[model samples]
Target chain A: MQVTVTTRTRSSSIAGYAAIALIVIGLALPAFASRSLIQDLFFILTMLTLAQLWNLIAGYGGMVSVGQQAFVGIGAYAMFAGVILWGMDPVPAILLGGVAGFLLAIPMAFFAFRLQGAYFAIGTWVIAEVTRLIIAQWKTLGGGTGTSLPREATSDIMGVEAIAQLFGLRDAAARDVLAYWLALLLAVGTMAAIYALLRSRTGLALAAVRDNDNAAQSVGVDARRVKWMVFLAAATMTGLVGALIYVQTARISPDAAFSVTTWTAYVIFIAVIGGIGRLEGPILGVLVFWGLQTAFSDYGSWYLLALGLIAIAVMLLAPRGLWGLIADRWGIALFPVQRRLILEGTRHG
Target chain B: MIWLDTVVQGVLLGGLYALFAAGLSLVFGIMRLVNLAHGDLIVASAFLILIVVETLGLNPFLAALVAAPALFALGWALQRFVLNRVLGKDILPPLLVTFGLSVALQNGMLELFSADSQRIAAGPLESASIDLGIVTVGTMPLLTFASAVLVIFLLNRLFYSTALGRAFRATSDDAVTASLMGINPKSVFAIATGLAMVIVTIAALYLGMRANFDPSVGPARLIYAFEAVIIGGLGSLWGTLIGGAIIGVAQTVGAQLNPEWQILAGHLAFLVVLILRPRGLFPRAVD
Candidate 1:
């Protein structure tokens, strides 16, 4: 951190504050906007959160996990169990889903951690499929058909609609607005957490592991444990976002829950296009991706094909991704994680 | 008596799965690339055989022979031009690109063939069967099983007994180092994919004869293939054979107990294998 904290930096801080304010305004927009528009925005933000979580693991950590959807599925099924069966409240139940997903990830982390590189990707996918098969026949949890979340789980708090109203989010005219606001908050929180985590000692170790596992382990870094922890963390975050996705939609099914489609294709596309290693890459990737999806939604598989073509083009032309290229060319540091020495020379405190 | 018949049918059915897994194993063993598009490539070859069969009115085997060379060329070009570029230090690039290719192929096939499921009409031979006292098995299945064994045997011979196969092993061990030893890494990969495509053509022949296939069937077939590979281990070719047998047996046995268990039982066996030996039953020394 530059100790001088330039006027430009101050202005940027103010810009961030303004951005938060705009989100707060958006949260209260239920009183103003159309129902459908808000709903679409909600979906976008939810997807943004999911993509961002993936970006952290695969992009920054350099752990390309094709099976984050497993955590997502676990999260959704956890919601089903917590809200539908255990009678937990909606908000708390979502948290429970996250926790359950974390617990599941821990054991999975132990097993899957043994596999390196592409093998790990396959391990994660296989684990997700196994979980799907188990839950598909559980009978109590809706089997392959799926089960519904009680509206009470996601609706008003303590039996009153006003509870949602208190946070400047009312579902009556704008469930989309409420959903958007929630997604915004989650996305921001995820960003902040990633930012903070990346700045930590362990984060440096994780980065080192990504650069070269043997090199990282040479100096007493337990690369395996660090990788496992990162995997678990990724699983937990993915699970939380997944719970939010299903909670917003109010339903869960084995196919939809465990759909690897929901996780990899877009996230990988977004992360790559936006530039993988940087924090801002996924954000840029999501906006561009959703924009394309919005435009090409009607073309069905053609849209998917276009996405694939673009990903291939990107990999060939600009492997560093969009924002990554920007960061390299412009020497810009929006969310700077690297240490830079100050001219002041007194530690810039 | 009927139970014995079903079991025999299941054993033969497992043979087809073994065929599916064989090509997949060859590719994976030589090049660690997963080839997410493998199933589609299989289907695509089947369509090629179908077209040749219809066009020349040639026998199905001759059509396959005609198509195999063309498929080999196509696969060689794909590996050389596209896949070879992405094979490097990071595995994700190949995975992502292949996944993209998978999507593209599925869409392309849908556009050309429509969504209708198809089977190559193998004419009267499809109904031909051999009865061995306790039970009878379709000629196609018997041929499929025999061919699977033959394919595996040939692959083994190639791997253990040939100069080209030795070059393949050497390349798999270390691409750069092998380059120092006069092996062209790119050509090796291209030939390997080409060889795998020949195997893919074999798989397509059996798949077209025995089951309905559309573009989407590739992914499901991929799942079975993947399960077989995992059950067998990462790199050992022979392990893939046993893996195919286990899945085939599990599914058939499960179906014998109850029909719904066909798919589920195989999945359960996969899970059981993973729990017991995450490295698979016969993990390769290197992997």
Candidate 2:
């Protein structure tokens, strides 16, 4: 008899092929898609990236942070400081944002880790508030009022010039295209990274730690280290995404950049509505969220109210979210992370 | 003299924060649930008082009295119907649900009452002051502090003396065992939430009279209340009051140094407390 363990499933194989095709289409989308379409896609892709990173921490790491805005705002602010203060290109400045996020996560983790459960959520929020308040005091970057990326800097951005020549487009359209592409890369990269992490040995240890800290520690899993790694990684990626978002907008204000509603609340909604703890969940969630936003955003407060109600209903009725419902009903595993053992000879004999 | 006045004002300010945190402490003590929408509920109660005062031409205090029963009923139904269903070992559902409720309540209030900031009119009492030779204090602040003390005293009395208090302790300690002893944990939770809402109404009364409030102010209020609860230690009422005073003093001092550091100072103080004593100043619960 021969037995082997496999994480692959038939659905995953199909999903792999579908993902390749989607990537190909995404890369070529700028050729035929309208400017508005590109911008909308940019929004979707960046949001998807944020959702994926958030799911990695809250869903997999068992650290539900409500202060992700701290990273986002810091990243965005760092990028702006790079451009306005150091006269660096916005593209490289985005990396500065990621580094800022990573640096901020160190102290943030130190403080927030002291708290447990729901208190941890509030602690993170307090830190984010402190960050915003301090950032508002930065007089060089227009202080609390915020500043726009210089017109020359934005128009003469690195990729914008290359895209302008290659696509025969105006600077504005080219910038949008460039942002859309970066967002696509980011979204794909984040998903791939998370998927690979979940399939690794560390992933199993992470799940163990999340399920039972003492049990995992008894088995040699460094629970705190794993949590620290997850928190730092999420913060870094969230910062990168935040930088990319602001680079696209070319505007940075303390309130708008550090908005809890836009950065944290909306991201939480996307993760929760799609299906947390699964790689495919955020993809499904971002689409539903985009659709709802498009449909109801014009109604202003009513739109937010509806979203809240829907999220609550999903939590109570389907704790697993929309994808959870679909996966359970169909036994689907589009991105299967679960391992299965197969016996060759002794199956039914 | 100036420093003394600042300290006096901070102590008075602590009274309001204690009121904001008292109901939260009560509910958390009874059930491990932390309602993220707590601040929003306080804001909603304030709005309710505003409506009663406007429509019926009643004083803000009387309006709060009228709104208290309604808030109690709302809280009872909210816990019985919504929050009770989500309470269990997994903390994710309750947190997410309350977060959603917070968002919903904020937006609902926004839709109903525009974005304009509103304040409750308290006639001449708003500006009335008292002189104690050392430092003068506003009459409203004095009244608010007295109310906070009275509420905490009554709550401590009830918690220590009543059968319902025993039931709260029993459910909090072991819900399954308490159920076996003929105390319905769910009903206890509902009554507890209702009682907390009544306190929220009182907090709302003072909140409206003290400052201007808008729909968007709830989250900040929540952070303050949360900091107070954490500073005081979980499941300890007197600890919450002291926590509130600590934050209040920090804010006043910060503001005196630089107005921008007011809120930042409160947060920093909370962080310092957390660093020094992660379990809080007077932690009552083992967990």
TM-scores, all models, native as reference: 0.89, 0.98
Q: Write the per-residue lDDT of candidate 1 for residues B133-233, one digit (tens) a residue.
A: 77888898888878888888898899879999888888878789999999999999999999989999999988987888887777667777877887888
DockQ of each: 0.49, 0.83
- Give the Cα-based TM-score of candidate 1 against the true structure: 0.89
Q: What proportion of the true contacts does each candidate reproduce?
A: 0.35, 0.78
Query: Hey, what RMSD does candidate 2 come out at?
Result: 1.5
lDDT of 2 by residue, A236-331 (tens): 999999999999999989999998888988899889999989988888988988898899878887878888888899999999999999999998
For residue B45, model 2's alpha carbon misses the true position, in angstroms, by 1.2
Runs in model 1 deviating more than 4 A are A1-22, A25-32, A87-89, A149-160, A163-173, A345-349, B1-11, B47-62, B111-115, B124-128, B274-285
lDDT of 2 by residue, B1-287 (tens): 88989888888888999999999999987788889999999999999999999999999999999999999999999999999999998788898899999999999999999989999999999999999999999999999989988999999888879999889888888899999999999999999999999999999999999999999999888889889988999888999989988999899989999998999998999999999999899998756
Off by over 4 Å in 2: A345-349
True contacts kept of 1: 0.35
Candidate 2 matches the true fold with a TM-score of 0.98
